[model samples]
Target: MKLLMVGAGLSGAVIARRLAEAGHRATVIDARPHIAGNCHTERDPETGVLVHVYGPHIFHTDDAEVWDYVTRFETFRPYKNRVKTTARGEVFSLPINLHTINQFYRKTLRPDEARAFIAAQADTSITDPQSFEEQALRFVGPDLYEAFFKGYTEKQWGCHPSALPASILKRLPVRFNYDDNYFFHRFQGMPETGYTAMVARILDHPNIDVHLDTPYAPGMADRYGHVFWSGPLDGYFGYDLGRLGYRTLDFERFTETGDWQGCAVMNYGDPEVPYTRITEHKHFAPWEDHAGTVCYREFSRACGPDDIPYYPIRLVEEKALLSDYAARAAGEEGVTFVGRLGTYRYLDMDVTIREALDTARAFLSGGVERGVAGVPG
Candidate 1:
C-alpha cells in the first residue's frame, strides 16, 4: 500500500516509518522547508549552541515506550526543566514549590508547615473552583496567585484568569516539597543532535519518500491509499465554519557573551513585562560550552492567519467549531487526522508519538480505513 503522510513532524515521521518498515511505501510532505513542526531545533551558527528554533521543548514523559522509540533515533542528554520567574523585581523558583512559599512569606517552613500555611491561606469560599482565578484562590490564595499566576496567565493567553477554565490551572505543578522541577515525568531528556535530525532518522527508511515545502490539497488524498494528516484540523477543511482560535508566539533574538540569564527558561510573571519568558539556548545544551550565548524573549498573542499557530486555544467557541470539523472528517474517506493540530488539542511529544505508532500499527494490521483518526485508546 502507498500512504501519504502529511506534516512531516513527529506524527507523520513515526507513522510513515512504521508503515514503511511493515513493507508499505510512504510519502511524507511538510509545508515548511524542514520537519519536526513546533519542536524543531538546530545549532546556532555563531555560538555553536543547540537552539530550539520554534521554542524550548523539553522531552519529558512517563511512557517508557515513547522514550525508547525516540532514543533509537538520537542520543539524549539528561535534562530537567527547572524554571525561574521574576516578580516585583525579585527572582523566584517556579511551580510554587516549598522554597517559593517560604521565600514569598519570608519564613522558613518545613513541608508540613508549608502545606498547613497554604491551606489556611486558601479561600474556603471557593468550595467548587470553576475558573482559573477560582482554582488559584481556592488552593494557593491571592498573594501567590497574584505573584505567580495572574499576570503570567493574562500575558500567555491574552485574557484574564477568570475567563479561563479551571482545568488550565489543574495541570500546573505545585509541589509541597522543595522540588522545583517543572515537569514530574520519570523520563526527561534533550536530543543530542536536535529534534529535526531525529525526525529525519525516523523517515530514512528505503520505502519512504519526503517532500518539503509541499502543501496538502484535499484532491491529493485520491493519489494514495490513505492520507494521514497531522496538519491543522481547520486548515485541512479550509476553515469553512470559522478559523479555530490559536495562540502564537513572537521571539526577539539577542546574543551575549558568556551566559545571558544563567538559566534555560526565565518566566516574567509581571504583566508589566511585555514578554512572557526568555530562554537561553546555550543553557538548554549544558554539555556544550561556548564563548557566546543565544537567547529569545518570547511574546504570546492571538494567532493571525499568517502567523505560525503554536497551541490551539480550545475555548468554548473553538470547541464548537472543532466538533463541526470532526463530524465532517468522520464522513470523509481515505483521510485520517493525527497529532495536536489535527486533533485540536495540546499534546506533548510523547503522546503524539504513541498515538502515531498506534495509528500505524492499526493500519498495517489489516485495520484498513478503520480507527485511523489517531486518538489513543
Candidate 2:
C-alpha cells in the first residue's frame, strides 16, 4: 500500500519507516526543514555546543522495547535530568525533593523525618482535592506550593493555579527521599548525535521518500492509500469548527563562555520573572565537553495561528472542540491521527513512538482504520 505520513517528526518517521519496511511505499512531508519536530537538535555555529532547537528533551522511559527501538537509530548516553529551580533569590533542587525541603525549611531531616514534617504541613482541611491549587495545598502544603509551584504555574499557564485541574499537578512527584532525578523512569538518556539525526536515520529507507518544507494539503490525502497525520488536529480541517487552546514557547537564544547555569534546566518559580525556565544545551550532553555554551530562556504563552503549538491546554472548552474535530476525523475514510497534536494531548517521545508503531503495524495487518486516540477503523 502507498502511504502519506505528515510531519517528519518521530511519529511520522517511525510510522513511515515501519510501513516502508513492510514493502509499502511512504512519502513523508514536513512543513519545517527538519526531520524531528520539537526534538530537533543542532550544534551552535559559534559555540559548537549541541542545542535543542525547540527545547531540551530528555529521553526517559520504563518500557524496554521502546528504549531498545530508539537505540537502533542512535546510541544513547546515560543522562539523568536533574532539574533546578530559582525561588526567592536561591537555587534549589527540583521535584520538591529531600534536599529542597531541608534547604527551604532550614532544617536537617532524614527521609522519614522529612515525610512526617511534610505530612504535618499538609492541609487536612481539604479531604477531596479538585483544583491544582487545592491538590498542592493538600499534598505539599501552602509554603511549598507558594515557593515552588504557585508563581511558576501562573507564569507557565498564564492563569491561576486554582483554574487548572488537579490531574496536572498530581503527575509531578513530591519526593521525601534524597533522589533528585526529575523523572522516575528506569531507562533515561540523551542521544549522542541528537534527535534529528536519530529520526533522519529512521526515515532512511529505500521505499520511503522525505520531502522537507512541504506541508500536506487536504487534497494530498487522495493521492495515497492512507494518510497518517501528526500535525495539529485543528489544522487538519483549517479550524472549521473552532481553534483549540495550546501554550506555545518563545525562546531567547544566547551564547556564553564556560557554563551558564551549571545545569541543563532551571525553572524560575517567581512570577516576577517573565520566562519560565533557562536551559543550558551543553549540559544536556554531558558526555561531550565544550568550552562554550548555548542557552535559551523559554517563555510560554497562548498559541496563535502562525505559531507552533507545544503544550495542549485541554481545558473544558478545548475538549468540546476536540470532540467535534474527532468526529470529523472519524468520518474521513483513509486517514489516521497519531502523535501529540493529532490526538490533541501532550505526549512524551516514547508514548508518541509507541502509538506510531502500533498504528503502522495495525495498517500493515489490514486494520488501518482502528487505532488508539479516537482513530476510527
Candidate 3:
C-alpha cells in the first residue's frame, strides 16, 4: 500500500515509520521546512546551544514503551523539570509545594501543618465548583489562586478564570512535601541530539520519503492509496464551519551571560506581564555546558491565520464548530485524521506516537478507514 502522510511531525513520522516497517510505501509531507512540528529544535549558530523552535518540550511520560521508543532514535540525558514563578515581587517553586506554602504564608509550618493550613484557606462554601476560578478557590483559597493561577490562567486562555473549565487546573498537584518536580511522570528527559534529529531518524526508513516546504493538496488524495492527515482538522474541510480557536505564541529571544533565571522555565503569573513564561534552553539539556545562555520570553495570544497555532482553545463554541468539521471529515473517502491538529486537540509527543502506532496497526489489520473523524480512542 502506498500511504501519504500530511505533516512530518511526531505523529506523521511515527505512523509513516510503522507503516514502512509493515512493508508499505509511506511518503510524508510537511508545510514547514522541517520535521518535529512544534517540538522542532536546532543548535544555535551563535552559541552552539540547542534551541526549541516553538517552546520547551520536556519529554516526560510514565509509559515505558513511549520512553523506550523515543530512546531508540536519540540518546536522552537524565533531567527533571523544576519550574519557578514570580508573584508580588517574590519567587517561589512551582506545583505549590511545602517551600512555596511556607514562603507565601510566611509560616514555618511542617508537612502536616502546611496541609492543614492550605485546607483552612480553601473555600468550603462552594461544594461543587464549576469554573477555573471556583475550583482554585475551593482547593487552594483566594491568596494562592490570585498569586499563582488567576492571572496566568486568564492570560493563557484569554478569558476570565470563571469562564474557563475547572479541569485545566485540576491536573496540577499541590503537596505538603518539598517535591518541586514539575511532572509526576516516572520517566523524564531531554533528547541529547535535539528533537529535530530524533524526528529525522524516525523518517530515515528506506520506504519513507519526506517533502519539506510542501502543503497537502486536495488533489493529492487521488494520487495515494491512503491519506493520513495531521494538519488542522478545520483546514482539511476548508474551515466551512467557522474557524476553530487556538492560542498561538510569540517568542522574544534574548542573549544573556551566564544563567538567566537560574531555572529552565520561569512563569510570570502577574497580569501586568503579557508573556506567560521564559525558557532558558541551556538548562533543558543540562549535560552539556555552555558559557553564555539564550532564552525566549514566550507571549501567548489569540491565534491568527498567519501565526503557528500552539494550544487549541477548545471552548464550547470551538467544540460545536469542530463537531461540524468532524462530520464533514467522516465523509473524506481516503483520509485518516491523526495527531493534535487533525483531531483538533492538544496532545503531547508520547500520546501522538502511541496513537500513530495504533493507527498503523489498524491500517495493517484493515480496521482503519479513510476520513475517520474525531479522536481514535
The number of the candidate with the highest lDDT is 2
180-199 in candidate 3: lDDT tens per residue? 99888988888999999999
* Runs off by more than 4 Å, candidate 1: 368-377
- Ten residues in a row with the worst lDDT in model 1? 368-377
Q: Count the backbone clashes (under 3 Å) in each candidate.
A: 0, 2, 1
Q: Distance (Å) between predicted and true CA of 115, model 2?
A: 0.9
Deviation (Å) of 174 in candidate 3? 0.6
RMSD in angstroms between candidate 1 and the native structure over all alpha carbons: 1.8
Give each prediction's root-mean-square deviation over alpha carbons.
1.8, 1.5, 1.5
Q: After superposition, how far is residue 307 of candidate 3 from its true place, in Å?
A: 1.0
**lDDT at 229, model 3:** 92
Please write out the lDDT profile of model 2 over residues 327-369, one tens digit for every residue.
Answer: 7887777888889998988889999999888888888788776
TM-score of 3: 0.97
- Residue 263 error for model 2, in Å? 0.8
> What clash pairs does model 2 have?
369-377, 370-377
List the candidate 2 regions with Cα displacement exceeding 4 Å.
370-377
